[model samples]
Target: MDYSHVRGVDPAVADALEGEVDRQQNTLAMIASENHVSEAVMQAQGSALTNKYAEGYPGERYYAGCEFANDVELLAIDRAKELWGAEHVNVQPHSGTQANMGVYLAMLDPGDKILSLELSHGGHLSHGHPANFTGKTYDVEQYEVDPETGYIDYETLAEQAEAFDPDIVVSGYSAYPRAVDWERIQDVAESVDAYHLADIAHITGLVAAGVHPSPVGVADFVTGSTHKTIRAGRGGIIMCGEEHAKAIDNAVFPGAQGGPLMHNVAGKAVGFNEALQPEFTEYAERTVANARALADTFSQHGLEVVSGGTDNHLVLVDLRPSHPDTTGKDVEEALEEAGIVLNANTVPGETRSAFNPSGIRAGTPALTTRGFDEEATREVGELIVRIVDDYDDQETIDAVAEDVQALCDAHPLYD
Candidate 1:
């Protein structure tokens, strides 16, 4: 974690950088939206390409001296197209929100209706949270998962679409743990003459690896984060049919953002190329397997695993059923003290406020990236149950902390 050059220039910032590395190395990162990228990706993200300013697409850049930048961007675009089979790909959006913004910019006008899943029901802010620009800019309505089944009620969603008569119907999700029926969502969109935007931000790698069903062909617009399960750089990507290529491209650049992050694009190119390999398929599969193991372990420990289980790389645990007295925040804080990191999330039919929700969301991507298999992930889940069951006990916390350290030691990271 030496930052000699940065140390001389700004010691304060350099110290925080080293601390962050140490933190990632020592802790269990179960955050669903995060994954550990490879050394090659880190190197590419830290390259000199950051100094370049490529404002436009490959052949029609507004700036001069973009030969290498063009090469990296073109490679990323090609790899993305091959990975997802989208007719057109845009690798320029700085984040997933911007990616959604691009789609909205291309296909919608102010006050146009947007029907999407509700935030508390596992949708993202970009899908039209009141705090976000989308909610304010567009007339928004939201759908939800079936409280009984913990899955999207496609029939109800379709009915809502008919009533709303939206311009766009948004699919995919942020905290959802099951497979999406893209065909079902597309049918709803078609029946109402609405474009569908599927946000595969969390399951990008799973979809690319053919583990989860992809919405690329079914939805009119598909958006994803470059990192998460895919191991790409921290950025965003948009994919659509050739019919809307220019609209998407122009919307992403001039409509949503300025110059692209060329260094991140280079890193994305490297990561996408890595995903194209056969090993990534194994990694993707193991990620879901580990999550299933974790969910099984938690359920065996008497915690209510949401949806009865998970078919993806994450599990949402609603604490209200088992630990009726405990909030998700209680378990989350206690787990962090014992070196198991995850987030407290809002569950479907949430009774509590967003700040401290009723459920906790845990993921296996980062742990799987650190070489954890089903057994290891199951062990981690057991450790979580211990902390959640005895959060106030210092001895329990310390004992669990030791076990967490052993796991981190057994499968070291950033070495």
Candidate 2:
């Protein structure tokens, strides 16, 4: 078979790769869940470690030639424990979903009740989505944020926890804008005698950088992605209290699947090391500042920001009032035409389908990492607002997109 065309390694593919790089270099990426990994992390991911496949934990590899691989993996685990203040760490899961699954398989029995935040109110599908393993394997109960305030209603959640009597209480969110009340969640989990699992996938970097409160002391288990604000390779991590260390390790390894991605683990170690640097703290802090600046700009332009505003790296903008008949899809398309990249998210109480949501989700982590600040964020925010407000004006939108490209050029990624 002539597999040359399928492999995408020829001239056409090379052009495509360059085009994608150009796109990233030119566009303002505001997806809250995405980030730009560092050169060191990238180097580690593409290193010689990719050749090895040690099918078990460090120092117990099935393969004979894994001495160096063991060292890298063990270093990643140790750094993760120190960074998050966990008694033990597992840096092997392929993704955030897999990390959560490992925890469930380790502790909970089939049909045991698991309480988590409602998906629409800012929770990951892996927490309890009906189509996910979490919902299929367990008796799932959900708590939601206040519809009006867009913040978690702690009192309401406490009442639900009291009523459901779940075996595990999950604390985490995908689109939440405000800080989580970890103390309250810990108290509730303690009262119910439920194990508390905090999935700090979105805020782990902030927590590590001290911009957000650490969930380590509050939750019995904490899981996070090495990506997002951490700016590492795409992988999951499980950090646990001493009591659950053995169970957590068993769940991640023999309980879940076999083998770990040695390459990604190496990248994770580099990212963890980078995160400990003074510059990374400044980067994380700037991410928060940029988010707030963008949110303030939106409010000034009369766009209704979900939860009123943000204290972190992302903001969910409610577009219902500004463009009554318009969907987030329309605004997203308009902005894309203007070279501004972001996701259309479903706001709480959204009547629209997930495919065409009523809200636009924007963040500043990528931009801040690219050296953007308050002024750049404000300019970007105004451009976003203008496009959404006058979505029908193609010429104006394109003109503003020109401005966006200019700004992106001034502050290039990984420069």
Candidate 3:
């Protein structure tokens, strides 16, 4: 993590980079979409490949001297195919949103209909939020989780799909904690003769480790970020059946992006190789177990754990039932001050604005990556509850900060 070269060039940027490394070492990162990549992956990402410009897929690159870039990209594609059992894989697209964009460009026209989960109820902005390009290009409708149970209402979704008659139906989520029924969603999509795009950006590693169900063979298109649950560097991937391979590739390259980030592709290669080992399975299982423990602790302490508990790496807590006066932002800031990091998230049937939502979302991926177990996660959950109970109490926050630093010390991150 030394920044000596950067310091020699520019002291200001070097200081910031060094400070960031120190911050990660000292705090707990509970953000659902974040994880610590292995040193191998990080080094690969920071490699000299960043200087290259390989404009196309492996062997068919438009530029000369792309031999090593071709090798790295091919290795990444092959590893991803093996990991997800997909017939075809595209390791281009700068991000998960771009991956989705690739799909829409390939299969949809402007003003085509899109059916997806509501953002507040566990959907992503790329699916169809008005602020994003997808919303501007497509005519969109949304489904939601059951108000009482806090779970996706499949029946309602089917009904919505029937009425909307969308050209595509999206199946994955960001904030929801329960397992998705991909086949059921596929059935609805099929009934309407619509394409199904499953975005597993948040659970790519979990699916690779067989901890979560995969949508590779079931959905018409599968898209994800290489980073979140996976230790891959920051990039996106798209997978589909062999029939649509050419279209996806062209859409990603000529349609959406120019040159692929070969350094990131190299990182994905290293991380995918790491994930292929048996230990990754244990890590995935422990991650889910830790989240369950966290959810149980929150519930036992009287917080309204959304959907009762979690089957994945995150737990969504609705603050209205237990602490109506407290906002998610309040808890979020207090926890950050206490060295615990998570996000203020909108919940199902949200009553507050998106900026100051009524729920908090926390996950165990980064913590689990740091060697945390169920017991350790439970302690972290207890500390979260303490902040939620008395966010304005500086003394309690100071005490929690001490305990959090001790936890960080016990489970050191980098060298």
Top lDDT hit: 3
For candidate 1, the TM-score is 0.99
If scored against the real structure, what TM-score would every candidate get? 0.99, 0.96, 0.99
The candidate with the higher TM-score, 1 or 2, is 1
lDDT of each: 0.94, 0.89, 0.95
What TM-score would you give candidate 3 relative to the actual structure? 0.99
Number of the predicted model whose TM-score against the real structure is largest: 3
- Please give the RMSD to the true structure for each candidate, in Å: 0.8, 2.8, 0.6
* lDDT pick, better of 1 and 3: 3
Give the candidate order by descending TM-score.
3, 1, 2
Can you tell me which runs of candidate 1 are displaced by over 4 Å?
A: none
Writing each residue's lDDT as its tens digit, candidate 3 over 135-225 gives 9999999899987888988888999999999999998999999998899999999999999999999999999999999888999999999
Please tell me which model should have the higher TM-score, number 2 or number 3.
3
